[model samples]
Target chain A: MNKLLRAGFSRLGRSCVFWLLTSFSAALAIFMCAVCFKNMNAHGDAVDAGQLMLNYSTLTGVVTAIFASIYIGVDYSDGTVRNKIASGHRRFDIYLSNLTVTTAAGLFSYVVFIITVAAVGIPLFGSIIMPLPRLFALLGCIFAAASAYSGIFTFITMSASSRTVSAALSLLCALALIMAALTCLGVLEQEKEILSGSVTDGESGEVEFVYSPNPRYPTESERKLYKTLLDINPAGQMLQLAGRAEPDFKLIPLCALSEFVAFTALGAFIFRRKDLR
Target chain B: MEYVLETNKLTKMYKHSAALSGLTMHVPKGSIYGFVGRNGAGKTTLIRIVCGLQSPTSGDYTLFGRSGGDRAIVRSRRRVGAVVETPSVYRDMTARENLRQQYRILGLPTFDGIDEILRLVGLEDTGKKKARNFSLGMRQRLGIAVALCGDPDLLLLDEPTNGLDPQGIVDIRELILRLNRERSTTVLVSSHILDELSKLATHYGFIDDGRIVREMSAEELDAECRKCARVEVTDAKALARTLDSMGIEYRILSDTTADVFAKINVSQLSSALSSSGCELLTVTERDESLESFYISLVGGGRHE
Candidate 1:
């Protein structure tokens, strides 16, 4: 057990540089969010601070996912995975050690981002802070997102032939997920429909404008569809939290937790069966 | 005496191709067992199986009388160190750091004997020098140092002298000899360099196409490789009669040439031949080298 822990710690220690860089980037993003919030307040604009914070957090999540891919991907690219196995480490231990290091780094980066956001928000927003339980719940959602993303990215890293391919695929997957979520929410449906019509007509056609008043709540069927989609789409829950007038801490975090478990288990299963060579 | 390592019809197949096909061998305790085979002859596969890096597909091996499938096989393997194909060392770490990491993996209590191991592999002075910057020979030495970490009694080295210079080869050769002679470490050394193996091997197992073609002791190999005098005589029958009378071992090669195993006085041999109605034409002494003997044993094209 001590040997296992020592091995885990050694792997974690080697990735300290990644943690440092992540913290620095999170700090920069938090600073930018503060400046954006301050500029909007100074202009007396009714800006959604929560949404801005969510965007900033999402950016950090994306960057952390990329970092995880590179960190674990390098060993696979360099034939070190085979070497470690040859040195008598069990496959489970190798996967678990890498997972532990990635988790620690992700949590470290998330904590740094959370602290910076809180430190900036309390001063500028006049201490109108979210409740501690709610904040912890929100951070739990963020941690789940990070863990699930890292797990999926770890699988990608192991399966990829090169670091470049792994990084590209990770970025592509993250972008595809975000874009798919936006498309599913009907944000791009009208524009897409118009483009399809134009291509069918063999000419560039103009889209007609249709104005509708903002509804106070979604229809029952639409709400049911959103819940069903959230169950399958982990990122959708983050969007739902960002779009809500009041944070639905219970629903969003529960969905995130389940997705986290599912993806992590899937990743572990895929990694355990892979041949090191 | 119990064999330190034994394979019972071990076979391994990769997908549709068979890498090892029923290879059976035995290495006696405290003996320098030379594993001789050509390139791609399942030497590394066999070593990997014994080292627990791989599993045999259709057979079993026993280490220290413990079968590979038994629970005690791991304990038996704990006493074995191997350098298969290439020396496994972290190029980013220093020699000491590499050893330390290996010690950690092995769960050793402390770094007590690390210094002595370094000195044993001639890397004692490589302080603070990372393996990446070390010369190939130094890296190879560091690999041996890592293998020595657990103080294993059985050492498996596969093609240790593959890429070494003459001096580097000699250095590794001397190190292996000293370890076996002084520490009584049983070594299973695989090499294509038959001449070099002949210098160190107490016993030999010749593998060809993933099968053991022969196994012999040093004395037996020497007896098989005896030196003889090749003599050309005008009358082969007369020369044979003379050799029969003198009780000398000789084989007739052709109408004019024959080989005699026993040494003889040149003048007396000529006089005997003359008296026997045969004229001595030419004589040349020849001794078989290990390489030639191996080539003859396995056949020439097979070695190629």
Candidate 2:
């Protein structure tokens, strides 16, 4: 197991893609911080720098997911998995090693992105603060999203033989989940009405008809379907945590934690028994 | 006298096709065992199964006296190296790095013997060049070097010279002989190149349709396939009598034809035949090459 870990690390260490993604995420976070600072100065008001930093961290989770999928998908496409099996490494070990590397890379990118956002945002937009529990919960959400994405992407990469097909399917599946979540939350219908120019201001011209959709008030069957979609969609849970107007974040972290464990177990189970060749 | 590998009714099926059906073979220790077969004869399948790359559908095998199902079998397999099909190598890694990766996989203490292994495979000067840039023959040599990582006593080479040039073939042939003769490594090499195999194999196993049709030691094969004088005689009884009186060994095919195993003085035999009232009609000396012998064993060549 130690040897397997070392081999995994060695491969990951030499991968130019891993470092490239990390640097890109850090640079993007810095850019996002600068944008938030510019907006705050234009408005002539103090900005919550930590909020912008957290937004960058949230984006890091999504980017890490994309990177993990591509990294693992390329190996499957090139038939390297077959060579690894032929070389006497157990199938489980190979899968685990790849998963570990991708997960670690994702987590590393998330950390760097978080640090860069915080470093630039706190000084430029004023000292933004968070309670200890809220900070821990936010970190939990980021880690959970990364872990779940790792599992889902690994499963996708192994199951599909072609990298293009895998990438397409991964993106399609992610979009489908987000679309389904928005429909369940009644957000899509409201957006559709707004886009079609049907939404209008009242007599006071206060934009009282501005729509906010929430599936929390759904029919029992729709609620059940929404719950099922939410259960599998890591991105849905992430958006729920990051985009909530109210700061109620405890359940989001707990949900993310459950997802992390469930997806990891599922990925490992399928990977161990898969015929690599 | 102990055999290094013994299989009892080993069988494997891929989907609806039977790749290896009841293949039972024994390879003795310290012998260059040639696994002879035509293409698609299950040579690679058998080697893959034994190397733990694939599972056999049924039956069992023992390596170094350890049964295939035993944990010790996997442990013993560590001492058995194989190059099945095309070489299994990372084309991006240099020869030295390739060996280093293998050593790491095997959990060797250090890369102390890597230089020696490279020299043994004639790849010592490959320097930092990756295997992808190597020629087919060079890749094959590096594959052998990967197999030699742990100094395995048993080496399984499947068609090692399959696509090499004549000189490259000779180099591999010489290397296999040197490995066997000097290091006493037991080799089980599979090849359709019967003549090349004949040069290296101390024992031969002829496989057809996934089963070993024949297995014989070199000396037994030699005697069975020895060249002899084939003569046609007018009188079989008289010819037999004359040969018996002269203390020669021969086999009479019919009243007209017989094979003379010993080299005979044609004039003396002619005089003997004349005294015995037998007429010698024709004399054709024939030696059976490995190709012809293999064809005879497996029926006419599949091509013919």
Candidate 3:
């Protein structure tokens, strides 16, 4: 296992995909910061460092999905996975080594994004408005969420035999998670009764607002389910971190940790039984 | 004789068909063992199972006298190296980089002998050239170089010269010979290219329908190969008629040539052909080829 991890990390260090994605992440942070800086200069708008820092969450999902898939899928496609197995490395060790490397890759991108955002955004927008401890805690949650994304995508890539299919599936899974999170957020954000429209009396030139119950609003039990889904889903947690709503800080990391463990176990189990050519 | 690898009724079943069914064979220590089989005859499947890339459905194999089911079998596998099907190479990386990666995986103390391994495979000067850009032969050599990283005792090469030019085939053959000669590495090479295998294999195991049909030393096979008199005549049809009336077994090579399995009087055959108004050309007696021997064993070439 140690040898596998060392080799995996060595490969990861020289991986073009990991470096390219990390650069893109950093460039994106710079771009976002520039846009915010331009807005502040042009319109005298306030910028929140916390929100900008949390923006890495949005990128983590897609980045981790693409990175993990390509990183792990190459083994199967190029037939290098056979080398590891034929060299007497256990299947579980191979799986876990991949997971570790991919998770580290995800974290690397996340850190680069954070550092880039802080280096540029702090000078332009000032320090985070939220307490330092609170920001750190949220950062930790986002890190956990990123690791969970690694776990999920690693499992998908490892289970798949073809690199092309695994990549497509992983990207699709990431998009689905994000869309599901947005849908949940939409449902949970609905008001019990909303202003539907304005009604004008026929006789008087006066307008009165009419209110109606939100048809899309969830029931009491349904609301709890959606909330729990939002808390558990990595993308949903990302949305929460990005200030879509207040995050259940304690539960988010707990769920992310559970997901990491579960997916790692399942992926290793599947890989152990998998037959390679 | 001590066997480096021994399988007892090893079986592997896929979803619809069995890839290996009650197959058994052995590779003796320090011998170049040829695994001869046609396509889909479970050659790669058995190699994959031995390499730990796939598990057998039933039965098991012993590597270096260790059972496949034992925990120490992993250690036993450390003495083995294989390049099954295509060469397992990281095409994106250069040959040296790929070797370094393999060395790390093997947990070698250092990348000390990579240059030597590369030189052994005739790839020492492939500097800065990624394996993707390499020719098929170079990539194959790189694959062998990677397999030679840890100085393994047993080497498994499956169709190593599948898509090679004549020169590439000779190079690989020479490299295998050198490895076996210098390091005393036991090699199990599976190929349908009987002529090439005949050149390298000291022992041969012929498999059919997921089972080994026969296993014999090269000396035994040489003794078993049939001898026949090859004859060329003016008219094969007339020669066939004369030979058929003589109650002799033969195979027609062409319109004017045939191999007679039975001994015949030269003058009698000549007079018989002359009586039929056909002239006998020439005759030479020689042993049949390994291809003919294989065809005689497996029944025929592939049927389209």
Candidate 4:
């Protein structure tokens, strides 16, 4: 088990995929920060550091999807898994190694992005609007989301034998998670309007008023379902955390951790029975 | 005999056909056991089952001493090195890197013998050459090098020389011989190249129709494959009387037939038998080669 972990981490840290992902993600955050700095100068509007960080965290999902497909797919295409098993390593260990390495890489990349953003933004934009404690809590949720992303994508990459299909499925999955989060964000952006009444157009002695409940506001059940969606989807968690809106969203981090555990366990179980060919 | 591998009625079935049906065979310790069979005759299927690439549908096998389904079988497999259909290798990695990864998988404290194993397989000079860029022969040698990393007690090679040139074949044959003699590693090599295996195998197991038809030592196969004559007569007792008098070695296959293992005058034998009130019914010259013997055992080649 130690050897598996050591070798897995060694490959994970050294592979081109790891470097490409880390650089891409860190570069994306810096680019987004630069846009905000420019916006502050041109429009004389204060930049929201927390919102900038939240908006760019979506790159974590994109970066993980790209890296996980290529990195894990290489094992099947090259037949190295056979080398491990034929050398007496269990299948469960192989799956766990992949999961651990991917999660580590994602976390490491997220840290790089955070540090880069903080180095530039703290001086340019002044202190962040969200309190330091809540900010840290949000960052913790993002880290947990990275873990969940690793588990979910690793399962897809390992299950499908074809690298092309695995990669396509991974990209599609990542895109779908972000799309779901974006939909939730769009829904929340609208202020719910209830008991609406409009009256008095005084142009031609027109005096009329109408009142009704707002259709856009989600109902109690809809609110619960939407929150559940945000809680389970790692990308949604990242968005929520980056926005600094989840102080009471305590269950979000737990959901992310559980997603990691559940997906890893399920992937390992299926892989154990799969024929290597 | 002390057997390193023993299978009891081992069977494996696909959805539409049986790959190994009630097949049982053995590999004695310290011998190069040649696994001879046609394609689709369960040679690779059996190799996969024993190597843990696939499971048996019925029956079980024992490796070293532990049987299948035993927790110790995984530990027991640590003593086995195998090259199943294709060489299981990381194509993008260099040869040395590939071996190092294998060393890590085996959990060796250090990459102590990587250099030695590479040198043993004649890949010492493949400096920084990724396996994908290697020649077919080089990749094969690298595969064998990977298998030899753990200094395993049993080596299972499936078509080790499948795509090699003549020189490559000789190199692999010599390497197998050396490994067996120097290390006493039991080898179960499956190949359709009977001529090469004939030179390397100390023992032979001929499988056909997914079951073993015969198992014999080299000496036994040599005796069985020798030049001989098939003879039939009206009275075997009289024919044996004449052949024994003439000091010819023979096996009485049936009441009216015998295979005589000597050159003789047909007329003289006929006259001798007739004088003893026996009639010579037929005399056919016979010489059975190994290929012919295998075909005879399997009934015909490439038939469903």
Question: What's the lDDT for residue B48 in model 1?
Answer: 80
TM-score of chain B of 1: 0.86
> Residue-wise lDDT of candidate 4 within B1-304, one digit each (tens)?
9999999999988887999998999999999999998888889988887877778889999998999778678888889998887887888788899888888778888999888898889999989888999999898988889999889999999999998999999999999999999999999999876788999999999898799998889888878888988999999989999999999999899999999999989999999999999999999998899888778877884754
Measured against the true two-chain complex, the DockQ scores of the candidates, in the order shown, are 0.21, 0.29, 0.62, 0.63
What digit string (tens of lDDT, one per residue) describes model 2 on residues A38-77? 7777887666655554565435444654666667775664
Tens digit of per-residue lDDT, candidate 1, span A135-250: 55666666666666666666666667477898888888877766656555553122212222222233656554544443434566766675566534545555554553244566
How displaced is residue A253 in candidate 1, in Å? 6.0
Question: In model 4, what is the error at residue A169, expressed in angstroms?
Answer: 2.1
> Top DockQ: which candidate number?
4
Residue by residue across A137-179, what tens digits does model 3's lDDT show?
Answer: 9999999999899999999999998999999999999999999
Per-model TM against the reference: 0.77, 0.83, 0.89, 0.91
How many backbone clashes are present in model 1? 0
Between candidates 3 and 4, the one scoring higher on lDDT is 3
Order of the predicted models by lDDT, top scorer first: 3, 4, 2, 1
Candidate that beats the other on TM-score, 1 or 4, i.e. the better one: 4
Error of 3 at A113 (Å): 0.7
Worst 10 residues of 3 chain B by lDDT: B295-304
Candidate 1 deviant stretches above 4 angstroms: A37-41, A44-88, A119-128, A158-179, A185-230, A233-277, B230-262, B266-285, B302-304
- Measured over all alpha carbons after superposition, the RMSD of each candidate to the real structure, in angstroms, is 6.8, 4.5, 6.9, 3.0
Q: Provide the global lDDT of candidate 2 against the true structure.
A: 0.75
lDDT of 1 by residue, B76-177 (tens): 876887776767776667888878877877778898999998998889898888788998888778777777778888988888888888999999999999
In model 3, the runs with Cα more than 4 Å from the true position are A199-208, B226-286, B301-304
